[model samples]
Target: MNNGAVIFAANVDRVARFYEVILTMSPVYVEPGLRVIASDRTELVIHGVPPQVLAPAASGAAPEPREDTAIKPFFVVGSLAKARDMAPLLGGFVFPPEREFTSRRFRACNACDPEGNVVQFRELLVSAI
Candidate 1:
């Protein structure tokens, strides 16, 4: 099954552009006030809704409930070098690379998105034969 995070924002177009120009992400689909930013295995969709019917809802039936953006989105990359290379493109600082607690071969860093969201990219080190 495909997994992704869907969010609602005040400015759908601006939000979409943030991911597109800043993060180097392209929209998988764009129409009807909906934008889906996608990478190889990651997707982040921002749906534009009327202000009157706006509400932040995480996992409930509410139209929208107050939600925090603290929950970061993590995407896996093939290498740390490649992920770090995106720092400039995103116009953000790479929080020093760190190894996973259980997996030393895996390294990750947090990058700030244009819309004030934190995104993480990780790469796994190949095991020796």
Candidate 2:
């Protein structure tokens, strides 16, 4: 089975640049709206948002819950604690780091990207050893 994921967001260039600059990923394609970033075997595709389409986050005002279609992007890091420590570097706020399952450490954090996308980050440590 192939376990693959693709997150489609409004303003693909902005989202793609976030990963490129912050995550240090270089996209295989330098297209205007479509780009693919790969690390080892895992890849992420960022496609441009169509015109006249309002992003989920922009469709509502503050104090209201994010819409149902809002995307919460998750990426596993080498150290949950360390990743949490670096949250501020990406303009992110860590929710609180803790062990989620018997075998992993996890945390939920959110960042308000320049394009107004609510980026949710989940840093997980697979094993303590």
Candidate 3:
């Protein structure tokens, strides 16, 4: 089955640039409030969300943002180090990469776009023969 994910961004263009650099792929589609970037047949859609929709109510009667409601998209990268280095340059923050027992050949890192959406990147380790 084909896999895809959508991320809401305050600035669609900015987030699109960030993913373009990390994925090494230009956006295949772009519009006023939307951008779609694809790599290896998988698509990542960045949608611009209006400030009013994301802002607290004028009456100060809004619930705080919840971690459980966040959308985290995981990406497989050719080089974690390169992606990590490029993240900050494109207005994104890259956490240090770590190897997990569940991911034998992958070193993963969590990164956030300027809009504060978490995106995970994983690098496949070369096998020693």
Question: What TM-score against the true fold does each predicted structure earn?
Answer: 0.58, 0.56, 0.78
Per-residue C-alpha lDDT of model 2 across residues 11-114, encoded as one tens digit per residue: 67655665555444667766776888766645678777766674533322232223355566666555545555554454333445442332346655554443
Q: lDDT tens digits, residues 1-129, model 1? A: 347887676557755665565445788888877999887666779888786765322221212212265677766656556555654454333455553322566667665443445666667667787
Off by over 4 Å in 1: 8-26, 48-70, 97-105
Where does the lowest 10-residue lDDT sum fall in candidate 2?
58-67
Q: Rate the local accuracy (lDDT) of all candidates.
A: 0.59, 0.53, 0.71
As for candidate 1, its clashing pairs are 55-64, 56-64, 56-65
Q: Model 2: runs farther than 4 Å from truth?
A: 1-3, 55-67, 70-73, 79-103, 107-120, 126-129
lDDT of 1: 0.59
What does the lDDT come to for candidate 2?
0.53
